[model samples]
Target: MAVRPILIFPDRHLSQPARTVQYFGPKLDTLIQDLMDTLRSTPGVGLAAPQIGVMERVSVIDFSRMKKKLKPAPCQDVRVLINPILLSGSGIQVPREGCLSIPDLLANVRRYEEVRVRIQDQMGAELILTASGFEALALQHEMDHLDGKLFIDRVLNLKTDVFRRKT
Candidate 1:
């Protein structure tokens, strides 16, 4: 697998909703690996296929790095979520969020503090799990990309909620 270039903000692909992943096999496996490679090459914990211009409802998340700091890491291992759907969410959290696509900006976007999602793993097996804290936030953030939405889109006031990150 190779690390693919991420679609930058304003790239039309980043604004287009991704198609559902209908098949599972080598092609899908490669895409998931590429996403994990790409995510590791960057500073982000999660990534979506749309972010790489794939236009497929696929995302990869890894929180292993946060295991030591956080008692319960949302993802102890790399997780591949294909055609994931948010099932239920409760509570609220608006932590500052940033995207690899929008490299220079961060925003305080609202997100559920806890969420349960149904997703198909790399092998296309459906499973549902609940997440909370940063794990929940990351799940919602990556899922947004499948719908062609960015964290900035959730900002209530662009001028106030969005800020440029220091280089």
Candidate 2:
């Protein structure tokens, strides 16, 4: 597993819908490993295949530390999702969002406060999960990449809703 360079905005591949993984083969395994490495190396809570220039429906998220109780604990156990599909979501909430692809920009984007997702694990087993709060937002944000949508595209207002990162 190795860290891959994240594709920045204006890269044509970032706007293209990812191709679904047809088989769980060696290539898919390598991709998942590289994604995991790259996601952990980055500062963000989650990452997707398109961000790493792979046009596949793959993502990894680790939101355990965001919960009130888990705040004191070190985050381990990153969840890998391959070919994820949002089953449902509810209760719209506007959250401060940022993207690895669109660096240095943060935006207020409306996302589901709670969501149920169905995805295939690294072993190609189907898993269903219901997530809320920051985890839900992270999942929705990463899944959006599969459909060729970025958080910037969902910004409520460019003038007021967007912000620049402090350096």
Candidate 3:
């Protein structure tokens, strides 16, 4: 597995909805690994297959490195979600979010404070889990990619909610 180049914003591929993962095998595993490698190489906590120009409903999230970014976060080391479906979301939080694909832009996007998702693991095994706080936000963010939606798309007001990185 290798770290794939992330497609920048405005790439047509980024706006296209991902196809469901109908087959699980070495390719899927490699995609997951590449996502993990790419995510670890960057400062981001989650990555979607579409970010790498792979229009597959797959994503990887690792919150271990975000300990300081979100206090009291109970996130696991890493999660591989294939064909993820948001079953239910509760509460609401407008967190300032950034995307690796979007580069320097950040936005205050509306997301669920807690979410329950039905997903398939790397092995194609179905599982359901609930997440809250940063984990929940990350889940929602990545899930959006599967539907061709970016964090900026969730911004209530583009003029007011979006900001550029200070750097």
Candidate 4:
């Protein structure tokens, strides 16, 4: 597995909904590894397949790194969610976020404070889990890419809600 180039904003490929991952094999394992590597190589908490120019409904999330950027988080494992479906979401939080893809800016995106998702692991086994707070927010944000959506698309008001990173 390798660290692939993450697609930047306005790239048409980022705007297209990802196709379902119908087959699982060595290729799928490689995808998970690449995504995990890409995410680790950055400060971001999650990375989706489409973010790497792969149009597949798969994503990797590792909350460990966010312990320094955000608040102390409970989900520390590097997780791979294939064909993930958000089963339920509760509460709401508008967190200021930055994207590895849209590297130059930050934005306030509305995300669920808690969420439950049905997803498949690399072995193609189905599993469901609940997440709250930062983990929940990260999951929601990544899932949007699977639908060809971005945090900007969910911004309540671009004029006031959008922000640029100070760095």
**So what's the TM-score on candidate 3?**
0.95
* TM-score result, candidate 2: 0.91
Measured against the true structure, the TM-scores of the candidates, in listed sequence, are 0.94, 0.91, 0.95, 0.93
| Residue-level lDDT tens digits of model 2 in 27-133 | 99999889878878877778899988889999888765353431232223588888889999999889888888988988999999888999997778998978776
Per-residue CA lDDT of candidate 4, range 1-167, in tens?
69998899999878899999999999898989999888888888889999999999999988776654444455557888899999999998888877788888888888888889999988889989788878888888888989999888888898999988888
In candidate 1, which residue ranges exceed 4 Å CA deviation?
67-71
- Candidate 3 lDDT score relative to the true structure: 0.89
lDDT of each: 0.87, 0.84, 0.89, 0.86
Candidate order by decreasing TM-score: 3, 1, 4, 2
lDDT of 1 by residue, 1-167 (tens): 79899889899988889999989999998998899999999878889998888999999888774433323765557778899999999998888888999999999998998999999988889999788888888889989999999999899999899999998
How many residue pairs in model 3 have overlapping backbones?
0
- Find the candidate with the highest lDDT and give its number: 3
Q: lDDT value for candidate 1?
A: 0.87
